[model samples]
Each structure stands twice: as structure tokens, then as C-alpha cells.
Target: MLEGLMLGLQSIVEPQHFLVLLIGVFVGFIGGALPGVSGTMLIIIVLPITYGMEPISAFILLTTIYVACVFSGMITAILFRTPGTPESVATVFDGYPMTQQGKAGQALGIAVLSSATGGMVGAIFLIFLAPVLATFALQFSAPEYFALAILGLTVVATLSGGDLIRGVIGVTIGLFIATIGMDPLSGIPRFTFESAPLLSGVDFIPILAGLFAVSEVLRRSRDDHSIKDTFQKFKTKIFDFPIIKKILTTLTRSSLLGSAIGVLPGVGATTAAMLSYSEAVRWSKHPEKFGKGAPEGIAAPESANNSAAVSAMVPLLSLGLPGGATTAVILGAFVMHGLQPGPMLFTNEPQLVYTIIISMLVINLLMIIFAKPFITIFSKIMNIPYSVMGPVILLLCVIGTFAVRNSMFDVWIMLLFGIIGFYFDRIKFPLATIILGVVLGPIAEEEFRRGLLMAGGDLSIFINRPISATLLGFALLALTLPLLKKVFSKKTQPPPVSG
Candidate 1:
């Protein structure tokens, strides 16, 4: 293990590899900071460029970009309520609220540090437990996947900002949004209403962009404020002892949870981040503080998403399975290089596998440095009055939404949802619940149908399998947690003092 680690270090720091790291990190930073650009998109654009490089060098470049992009995405989410990628959606819940409270520096610090920590933890797991995790991941068939999605849905209760009923309603609307377009199994359109564009379904990019970004601009137009300069407090000190101590448990738990979830093929970092945020809320003593600038809230999703992004490589490197969309693209790069990533790849090129894993860890650490100056510079955006910033943000939302498919229909959908989001906020509905419904609904539906097919519609397959059953049990726990917290708070409350 030490020899492999040393070899990876030697390979990555060589002048050519080192230069690629700088370039990759720089490109990823800009890509992720720009709303609507995803790590998958960045990697795809660079895929042709990697063709001329040695296979190992190419992978190092891609891996660096993926790691840096995932972490840097929280920049916009914290600074503005814009999630640069779907994976950072959960970050906006508390991160932007922290910005509202003049704690933008602390929020950015927590996000960056937690992301680095999570990446290191995931890299360790990949190094030490790839075989075990890959074996575990393979157990997640249709039934288990369905149960996992159910567990993810239970997060809606926690994200409600204490209004479970409004949260449920928001989610109902979101599920309807998810069911638009054709039925995956039957090839029948459900909610298109005969519209040609609706046949393709509403993409999450536009809806999410509208939900957080466009609505935010509309809201700010009502009462705009100049951004405060909080750069001095934005320390890149990775081992900030006080903040680390405050969120150590949430960070560690989320990292482990995200790493475990990321091992499953098809399950992306978004789910990991959402579930981790939910679990943090589930276990925290002050659940009500979650959506109101909680440090734990910022740390949980940031760490989880970053950790999941790294551990996602395990299946790709070990079992010839792509862990998520980005890894699927990375698999294409592997093929382009005439290298297959599976057991044989490991057996044939042990150093190569280790080098990729080690490079991921190195990149995560380097990101703190890579991101620090950028954060300092971006912090200056706070000085831009909303008068100027609002129009620019609104434009970003429209362009980002339109960039997804280069279709004006998407832009219109985003504009429509921008109004809906404004109304939802007017009524104090929790935005996270709507997002969760849209995100998890399709996963649940697809997996549930497949599980039934596997069981001849017995319905017991979900409970008959231990992993599936355990996850379902966790879902039940997630649902009842809010009630449990309410009950506990009541029981522990002292008698009201006489007026």
C-alpha cells in the first residue's frame, strides 16, 4: 500500500502531470462556479483533448477536474442561492441563508473544508475498502434501489422548515413534474397535453435554475441590498479547529454515508448530498436551525457530495460499472484510451488504479489552495448591489436553463417556474421538498416497477431482502424523526412560568 501510494505521488508530481493538474483545477473552478455547467459537461468537452496524452496522464487530468468541479460548485450556492450543479442543491438551503446573515465567509469556509475532508475520507475508503464496497454495491438491485429512493423521499419531512404539511404539498407538485413526459415502461405520455416539447419531459436543470436562481432575482428586485465584503473571515485554513470541532460528527457521518451510497451504480452525488443533509437534520438536537444558517447544514451536504463524487470511482475502477453520469463519461474516456477499467485493469495496471485514487486525494487537498484566492475574488461580488447583480443573475438563470438543450421551451419552463417558486416562497413552502420529490420520484418509480417484475408482483421483495428491508426501516425512522423530536422537546420542556 505504501509503495503504491508513493508511486502515485511520484507519477502525479512529475512536471507534465503537475501542469495538467493546474490547468484542470483552473478549468474546473471556472466551470463549476458558472451556474448550469456540470462536471460531466466539462469532462465531455475535454475528452477530445485527452486523446493525445498518455492514458495515466489523461485520467489524472479528468479526475482532478471532477474533484475540483464538485467542490467548487458550492461557491455560487453559498454566495448566491444558485447551485452550480444538481449535486450542490442541498447546499443552498443553509449556505445562502448564512450569506443572508453576514456569515458568508464561515459558510464558504465550512463548505470548502468539509469538501476536502470528505474527499480524503472517500479516497481512504477507496484505497482500503474498494473490494468490500464494490461487493456491497453489487447487492443494490432493483428492490434495494427502490428502498433507497424511499429513504431519500423521507428527507422531505426534515426539509420542510418545520411545516410538514406544506412540504408534503410541495413534494406532491414536484412528483407531478417528475411524471411529465412519457412513461418509462409503457412508452405512453402522461402529462404532455399533446405538446411536442413536453414529450421529452422537463429537465431538472431548468426547474432547479428557476426555483433557486430566477425566483431569487425576483425576490431581490423587491428589496435589493448591496453585498457585504466578508473576505477577511474567509479563511482557507483546512484544519480550522473550532469549526471542525463544531461539525466533526456531522462531517464524518456524512462522509461515510456519502461514500457508501456513492458505491452504487446509477445513484449520483445529488442523492448522497440530500440524504446526508437529511440525516444531519435527523440527528441534530436543533432540527429547526437546519434551514436557517446552520453550520451543520452547510457541512453535511458539501461533505457528502464531495465524498460521494470520489468514492463513486470505486465501482468504475473495480467492477467495470459507471457509478454515475460523470463516471459513465469517464468510462468513455477509458475506452478511448484503449484501457478497460475492471478487475483485469486492476490486475494489469495496479499502479494506474492507485495513481488515480491518490491523484483524487491530492486534488482535494490542492483544491483548498486552488479555491482560496478564487473565493477571495468572488467574495467581491458581494459588493455589487442587487441592482446590477439581479439582472446578471436572472440572465444567468435563463442562459443556464437554455444551455441544457439549446431550446427556448426550457427557458419558458424556467420562467414559468420562476413565478411558481416566487409564490411558493410567498407561502413559506420549503423549496427542498419540491426538489427532493422531483429528484427521487423517477428513481423510486423505475426501481419499484423493476422490483415488482423481479418478484412477479409479490410486493414482498422490498422487505424480503435484508438490505432493502434495512433501508426501508431507515425510511420509517426518517419519517417519524420530526415527530420524535417534537415529542422529545415537549417532554423536556420546563413548565411555563406564570406571567
Candidate 2:
């Protein structure tokens, strides 16, 4: 094990590999700072450029971007109400509120510090546990996978942001959108409207860009609100050891929970973030203060999401199964280099696998050092006029979506989803729920179908399996608790937090 660690360190410390790591960190920070963009999108966009590079080098570059992007996303979420990616959505609840209260620097500082710590902890967990965890993950057959996917989708409960109906509506719309392409089981098209491109279904990148980036652009254009630049006057230092210690103490359990969830296939960063946020709320001394500017709200989700992002690599690196869509894309990079990930990877190329793990740790540490100066710079972007910023964002959305598949159909999809997102926003629906549904619905359907087939069409299969049963029970709680609250609670308006 020590020999493997040494080789991994040596491989990534080279000038060429280190240069890619630097580039990746730089790109990732920018991507995360930009609302509507994410670490996963950044990786997918740049993947073609790495086609000719060696497997380890390319893996290091891509994973570095992924790691840094996850952390850097909190910059935008904290400074602005806009989340840089879905993973950073929870950051905005307390982070933007902190900014509004003239503590932008402090919020940014905590997010950066906590995210870096969580990422490193998760990396360490991955290094020690990936092999053993991968063996356990192999036990997850279709039934367990489906149950886990349902459990992930249940995150809408917390993500709905105090509007349960709107959250349900958002999820329903997303699931409706997910059904727009050809039927997966049947050969016939479902909602393609006879367009050939829809046969493969709505692509994830464009839908994500449209739902988040373009819609935000359009909505912000209608508003005459200006971002307050309180950070300029706020004298706050980034390094707060006491605050870091406190955050670590509060977030350790949540971070571990997120890492465990992330190791499961089909679950993604958003779920981990949402679940951790909910758990933090549950454990908070002031539960009612959650939607308000509670520091723990910022810390818990940021830590958990970053941890989840890193731990996701475990399944991808050890087992052949892709942990999520982003990891699935990473798998393509591996295949491009004539390499396959699985048990064989352990025996055949320990150095390569170990190098990727080591690179992740290095990239996470680098993000903290690199993010402080950039956070001040990013805070300025919020002050840009909405009118001028709107078109530029629209253009980015168009370009990013088009770049995904070089398809006009995707561009159209972006516009249509943009309209849908705008309507959802106007109706007070939770857009995050919709995005989660769109992302997870397919996986849930696929795994459920496979599980049923394996169980001879027995509906009891979900209850019969131990992991499946536990996950299903958890899913039921997620789905039902809000409804129970609605039915039993008093008819009083909740206190408004600083938005």
C-alpha cells in the first residue's frame, strides 16, 4: 500500500501531469464561479481535448477539474443567490443570506474552507476504502440500485425550500420532460413529435443549462435589482482556524453520510447535498433558523456535497459501474485510452488508479490556496448589471448546449426547457426538484424494470431485499413527512429569512 502511494505521488508530481492539474483547477474554478455551469459540464466539455493524452494524465486533469469545480461553485452560491452548479444549491440558502447581511467575505471564506476540508477528508476516505467499498457495492443488484435511486429522488423534500406543492410540481414536470424521447423498453418513440434527434432523449447538459443558466438569464433580465457589493467594505480573513474546527465538528457526520451515499451507484452530488442539509437541520439546535442565515446550513451541505463528489470516484475506479452521469463520462475517457476500470484495474494498473486518487487530494488542497484571491474577483461579477449580464449568459448557455452534441435539436431543447423553467419559476415551483427528477428518473426506471424482471415480476422484490427495503423505507419517509406536516401543522405564516 505504501509502495502504491509512493508511485502514485511520483506519477502526479511530474511537470506535465502537474501542468494539467493546474489547468484543470483553473478551468474548474471558473466553471464553478459561473452560474448554470458545473464541474461535470466542464469536464464533459473539455473531454475531447484530452483524447490524445495518456490515461493517467487525462484522468488527473479531468478529476482535478471535477474536484476544484465542486469547491469553487460555492463562490457564486454564497456571493450571489445563483448556484454555480446543482451541487452548490444548498450553499445558497445560508450563503447568499450571509452576503445580504454584509458578511459576504465571511460566507465565502467558510464555504471555501469547509469545502476544501470536506474534499480532503473524502479523498482520504476514498483512498483507504475504495477497494473494500467497491467489493460491497458489487452487492447492489438492480433492486438495490432502484431503491437507492428512489431514495436519491426523495431529496426534493428538503430542496423544495418550504414549498412542498411547488416541489412536487417541479419533480412531476422534470419527470414529464424525461419521458420526451424514445421509449427505452419499447422501440417506438414516446414524445419525439417525429423528430429523429429525440430518439435518444433530451441530453443532460442542455436540459441542465436551460433549466438553470438560460432561465436564470431570462428571469434576471426582467428584474431591475442590483447586487450589493458589501464584500468590498467587509474586512474578513479567509483562514479562521476556530471556525474551521467548529465546521469540522458539526459536519463530520454529514460528510461521512454523503460519502457513503455517493459510493452507491446512481446517486449523485445533488442528493448528497440535499440529504446532508436536511440532516443538519434535524441536528441543529435552532431548526427553525435553517432557511435563515445559519452557518451550519452553509457548512453541512458544502462539506457533504464535496465529499460525495470525491467518494463517487470509488465505484468508478474500483467497480466497473459508473457512479453517476459524470463518472459515466469519465469512463469514456478511460476507454478512449484503451483502459477499463474494474477489479482488473486493481491488479493490472495499480499505479494509474492510485495516481488518480493522489491527484484528487492534491487538486483539493490546491483549490483552497487558489480560491481566496479568486473569491474577491468573483464577488465583483455579482455587481454586473443584470441587463448586460443577461445576454452574455444566454450566449454561454447556447454555446455550451450546442457544444454538447453539435445538434440544433439540443439548442431547441434548451429554448423549450428555458420557457418551461421560466414558467415553473413564475408559478413558485422549486426548480431544483425538477432538475433532480430529470437527472434521476431514467436511472430509477431502468433499475426498477431490471429488478422486476429478475424477481419474476414480483412487486415484493423491493421489500424482500434488505438494502432495497431499507432504502424504500427511507424513500417513504422522504415522500410522506412533508405531507404529514401539511396536514397536521397550524395555519401560520413562517418567518422570512433574508433572501
Candidate 3:
């Protein structure tokens, strides 16, 4: 592992790779600081640019953006009570309060410091845990892969903060979308509607651009033209050692919790951050200070959010499953590059894989420098109005999607998915699940069919395989546990007194 990591380090320092890494850091900070721009959206918008680059460089840029953007989102959440990303929502609880108290510097400092620390912890998790997971996954066959894919979809739906029915609905949409092209086993058109363009099926990039980026444009179409708000200005290094000592416990706890949660497929940093914040409140000596201006409050969620953001790579690298929306997009990058991420990737692309792991450490260190002196600069970037922001991003989406194949049909597909995405958003369906379902649906169906063929049409083959059965068991749990927990919680609640 150390030898691989050293090789990765050497590779990243090469001129081309290093330059992209720096660009990722810079772009991520600015994009994340913007209220309407998410790391996922930024990745999709800029994805086409990476088509000409090396796979390692492409991944380094996207993953770096993922980590940096997650941390920078707290900047706006702290300064303006408007979270730059959903993952930063918990930060606003204490972050903005500190700003209102004229301690914005301290809050920003604590948040950034904790975020960096958390990222390092997550990197450590990736370095140590991912390889082990990959090695174990080497034993998987078609049955196991199918079960893993099913588990991935279930986890996304269950943890995505909505009713199971809605989540299922989202997954169904993605599965239907996945079935648009030729059958893998049989060379037959499935849903082309006699259209030549549909013969190639739907491109993931255009649909992704639509669902995330262009849909964001329509989602913000109703907003006022100008954001008349400004940051509570502050000055200081984005680190404070004195407070770090006080919140060490919070940082350590949240970082571990975040990295662990990150391993669960499709459970993103948003969930990790909120859970960590609540855990901080549960365990704090002065819980009352949390909603006011508690440093621990800032540390807990920020640390977990960034840690989970980085560690989300673990599943993507090891299991071929994305742990969140941003990583799902990263998974697309892998596929675009003709690289399927999984156990085989570790064997086939050790240099690229290890370089990515090592790059996590680099991203965290660079993030401190990227954020420290540029708080004001990022603040200005975030203050740009949605009206202007929306149009620019929409234009980028069009240009990026069009560049992929130079086809107008692809552009039209993007627009069509945009409306689907808009409707999905209106119904409060999690986009991540649809991405997962679309990505995983093919894997599950393909693997199931392949497994059955291998088993000579015996239905018991899936259950007879130990690893496959275990994975399916977990999938069942992922699907049912959340609903069971909700039911139990409600039933255990004291009945309302006839109100």
C-alpha cells in the first residue's frame, strides 16, 4: 500500500496532473461557495472538459472538487445563513449565529479547520479500508454483483429522506430509463421507438446535466433576480488552534462517524452532517450553546460533512457503487473513461487508483490554503444572484452536453430529462436514487440474467451462493429497516389526547 501510495504521489506531482488538481481546488471553492451551485452540478458542467484528459487527471479534478466544494459550502452558510450546498445546512445552525455575534472569523476558522481535519481522517479510512473491501469483492460473481447492485439501490432509497413509496417511484423511473437501449444479452432494440438516435440509448452525461444542472436552473427560475444579501465580513486565518483543543472530541467523533457513514452506499454527507450535529448536541456538556454559537456545533457537522464527502469514495473505488450523488457522478466519469470501478480496477489500474487515494490527502491540505486567504473572494462569488447564476450554468450545461457527441439529439435528450428532473424535484424525489437506479439497474438485470444462465435457470442459485445471499440480505435490510424504524417510532409514540 505504501509503495502504491508513493507511486501515486509521484504521479500527482507531474505537471499536468498537478495543474488540474490546483484548478479543481480553485473551481471547487468558488463553485461550492455559490448558493445555487453544488459540487455535483459543477462536476457535470465541467465534465466534458475532462474528455480530453487522462483518466487520473479527470478523477483528481472531480474528486477534489467534491471535497473542496463540500467544505466551502459552509462559508456562505456561516456568512449569510444561506447554505451554499445542502450538506452545509447544519453548519448554519451555529455558523450564522457566530457571524451575527461578530465572531464570523472564529466560526469560519473552526469550520475550515474541522473540515480539513475530517478530510484527513476520511483519507485515512479510504487508504486502509478500501483495499480490504476490494480484495474481498474479488470473490464476487454475477450473483453477488447483482445482489450488491440491488443493495446499493435500496440503501440510496431508504436513507434519502423520503417515504419508501416515493423513493421506489424514483428508482422505477431510473430503471425504465436504463432499459432504453439494446439488450445486453440479446442484440435487440428495446425502447428506441424506431428512432435512430435512441438506438444508442440515453447518454448518462446529458441526462445527468439535465437532472442536476439544468433542473437547478428551472428550480431557481422563480427566485428574485438579485440576491440583496451580503456577508458579515471577517478577517483572520481560517484556523484557530485554541478552539481546536476544545473541540477535539467533537472533531474526532464526527470524523469517525462521517467516514463510517460514507461507506454506506448512497448515504451522502448531508445525512452524515445532520446526524453528527445531533450527536454533538446529544453528547455535549453544554447542549444549550449549540443553536447559539457553539464551536463544537460548527466542528461536528463541518468535520463530518467533509470527512463523509471524501470517504464517499471508498465504496466507489472498492465496490463499484457510489455512496452519494457527487460520487455517482464520479462513477460516470469512470465509465466515460472506459474504466469500470471495482475490484478489477485495483488490479488493472493500480497506479490510477492509488493516485486517486493519495490525492485525497493533497486535496485536504490544499483546501486549507485554498480557503484561508480567499474567504472574501469566495463570499463575493456566492453573492452572485440566481438569475445570473442560473443562465450561466444552463449555458454551460448546453455547451458541455453538446460537446460530447456533437449531436443535437443529445441536446434534446438533455432538455427532456430536465423536465423529468423538474417534475421529480416537485415531488421531492431524491435525484441520487434515480442516478443509482439507472446506473445499478443495468448491472442488476444483467448480472441476474447471467447468474441464472450459469445456474441453468434454477431460481435457488441466488440464495445458494453465500456471498450473494448475504448481500441480498443486506439489501432487504436496507429496504425494510427504515420503514420498520419509522413504524416503531410512531407506534411507540404516546397517542395524542384527542386533540
Candidate 4:
């Protein structure tokens, strides 16, 4: 292992490999700062270009891009309330609120710091715990996955603010939308209404773009006030040691949570972020401050998503299983180079694997250095008049949405979702809850059905497995805890001052 690490370090320092890493990081940063442009899309675009490159260099470039892009998404999410990727959706909850309060620098600074910390932690786990975590992840079957998804769905309580009913309504709406495509088991459509595009279900990128980006545009358009007048001066210094110290606990907790969740197949950074955000709120001393420019808010999701991005590579490296869409693309890149990524890869190409892992650590440190100047530039964006910025954001939304599938159908879907998002925002509904439903509903349904099939339609399987039972028990507790607390508090409180 030491010899492999030395060799990997040597390879990354080579002039050509170093240059490729820098280029990848730069391109990834730009891609992730643009709304609707996800790391998966960027990898797909750059995959062909890597065909003529050396295998090690290609791997380094792609992996660096993967790590950098996950962190970069928080930049736009903080500055403009627009998440560059689905993983950064949680960042928008607190990041944009901070920006609105003239604390864009602090928010961006925390995001960069937390992301770097999380990435480093994940790299450590990938280096030392990959095999162990992969073995543990192997224990998860359909029943376990279904239970985990249910546990994740319980986060709706945290996102609902004070409106649990409305949150459930939002989640139901999202679940319905997720069901629009073909049935996972049967070869039949449910709610496509014979539309060819709906057969593929709602594309997440366009929906995210519309919900956050286009909706913001419409909301701003309704206001007669000029954006420039309300804009605060951009802060130049991006680091705040005091704030960093303040949220170290949240950062550490989120990083661990993200790395753990990332090892599970099909559960991506998005879920990690949402779960981390909910956990942060749960453990916080002042949970009411979350989603209102709380430092812990930015720290939690940014850390989790970045850590998840790195640890998601564990399953692929150890078991040849892609943990998420970005890693799925990297898996294709592996096959393109005539190299497999399972346990055998370790023996066959030990140095190569170590090089990729080491490069990720270096890439994350470089992101921190590179982001400082960029944060200054991004913070200035808030000063632009909404009249000018709104149209540009809309154009980017249209172009980015169209670019996702190269279909005009997606553009229309984005527009429709933008309208829906605007209406939801006006009605005080929780958009995050709906997004969570859309993202997790399909996974839960498919896993539940698969578990039933495995059990020959017996419901006992869920509770029969210890892991699944524990997770479901946690979900049940999570669902009932708030009400239980409310009841208990009422019993303990003084009798309304005996009035």
C-alpha cells in the first residue's frame, strides 16, 4: 500500500497529468456553477475527449472533475438560489437566505470549507475503509433499501416547518409525478397519457432548473423593486475562522453521515445531502434558525454532498457497482479503457487505483484554493439588476434544460414546472419535500416490490431482517417523535399560568 501510494503520488505530479487535473477542475467548476448542468452531464461531454489520453491521466481528470463539480454546485446555490446540480438542492435552503441577508461571503466561505473538509474525510474512508464499507453495503437487500428509503422520507417532518399536512401534500404530489413513467416491474405505463416524453418520466434536471431558477425569475418579475438597489456590497474576504470553528460539529457529523450513505448503491449525494440537512436540524440547539441563513445549514448539506460524492466511489472501486449517476459515467469510462473496477482491479492495477484516490484528495484541496477568487466574483452577481439577471437566468435554464436530453420536450417540462414551483412558493408549500418525494419515491416503490417478490409476496420479510427492521423502526419513531414530544411537553408545562 505504501509503495502504491508513492507511485500514485509520483504519477500525479507529472507535468501532463498535473495539467489535465487542473483543466478538469476548471471545466468542472464552470459546469457546476451553471444551473441544470450536473457532474454527470459534464462527464458525458468530456468522455469522448479522453479516448486518446493515457488511462491514468483520463482517470485522474475525470475523478478530479467529479470531486470539484460536487463542491462547485454550492457556489451558485449560495449566490443565486440556483443549484447547479440536484445534490446541491439542500444548500439553497440556507445558502440563498444568507445571500439575501448580505452574508454571501460567509455562506460561500462555509460551503467551500465544509466541502473541502468532507471531501478529505471521504478520501480517508475511501483509502482505509473502502473494503469494509463495501462489505457492509453488500448486506443491504431490497428490503433493507426500502427501509432506508422510508427512513429518508421521514425527513419530510424537518422540511415542513410548522405545516406537517402541507409537507405530506407536497410529498404526495412528488410521488405522483414520479409515477408518471413506465412501471418498474411491469412493462406498462401508469400516467403518461400516451405522451411519448412522459414515458421516460419527469427528468430531474429540468424540473430542478425550473423549480429553482425559472421560478425565481417569475417571482422577481412580479416585484416592482429594482434588484440593484436592494443588493448589498460584495465581501472580498471569503474565509471566516470564527464561523468555521462554530460549525465544526455539524461539519464532522455531516461528513460521516454522507460517507456512510454514499457506500450504499443507488443512494446518491442528493439523498445524503437531504439526510444530513435533516440531521443537522435535529441535533441543532436552535433548529428554528435553519433555512434562515444558519451557518450550520450551509455546512451540513455542502459537507454531506461532497463527502458522498467521494465515498460513492467506494462501491464502484470495490464491487464494480455504480453508486450514483456520476459514478455510473465513470464506470463507463473504466470499461472504455478496457479496465474493470471490481476487486480484481486492485490486484491488476493497484498503482492506478491509489493514484485516482490520491488525486481526489489533491483535487479537493485545490478547489479550496481556486474557489477563493471565484467566490469574490460570484458574490458580485447579486449586485446585478434583476431585470438584467432574470432574463439571463431564464435563458440559461432553457439552454441547460434542453441540453440535458437535447429535447424540446424537456424545455416545455421545465416551463410547466416553473409555473408549478411559482404557485407552490406563493402558497407557502415546501418545495424541498416535493423534490425529496420525486427523488426517493421511485426507489422506495421499486425496492418494496422487489422485496415482496423476494419473499413470495410475504410481508414478514421487512421485519425478519434485523437491518431492515431497525431502519423501519427508526422511520416509525421519526414519524411519531414530534407528536410525542408535543404531547409530552404539554403534559409537563405549567397550566397556562393558571389564567
TM agreement with the true structure for every prediction? 0.61, 0.69, 0.97, 0.62
| List of clashing residue pairs for candidate 4 | none
- Best-to-worst order by TM-score is 3, 2, 4, 1
- Per-candidate local distance difference test: 0.79, 0.76, 0.87, 0.80
Error of 3 at 309 (Å): 1.2
lDDT of 4 by residue, 1-499 (tens): 6776788899889999889999988878876876545676567556656777889999998898888889899877887777978889999999999989888878888898899989988888788766554456567788987887777677666567657788788778877887888887897988898999888888666666667667767887888635333435565344687897889999999999999988765567888999999999999999999989999999999999999999888877875656655675687578668896656677688778888988888988898898887655655543455577567667767776776667899999989988998998788777767766766677779889999999999999999999899989987887788778888999998887554
Stretches off by above 4 angstroms in model 4 are 1-131, 223-360, 375-384, 497-499
lDDT ranking of the models:
3, 4, 1, 2
Best by lDDT: 3
Let me know the TM-score candidate 1 reaches against the reference structure: 0.61
Candidate 2 residues lying further than 4 Å off, grouped into runs, are 1-11, 14-17, 34-66, 73-114, 162-169, 184-186, 225-356, 372-389, 455-462, 481-499
State which candidate, 2 or 4, has the greater lDDT: 4
Candidate 1 weakest lDDT stretch, 10 residues: 227-236
How far off is residue 176 in model 4, in Å?
Answer: 1.9
The candidate, 1 or 2, that scores higher on TM-score is 2
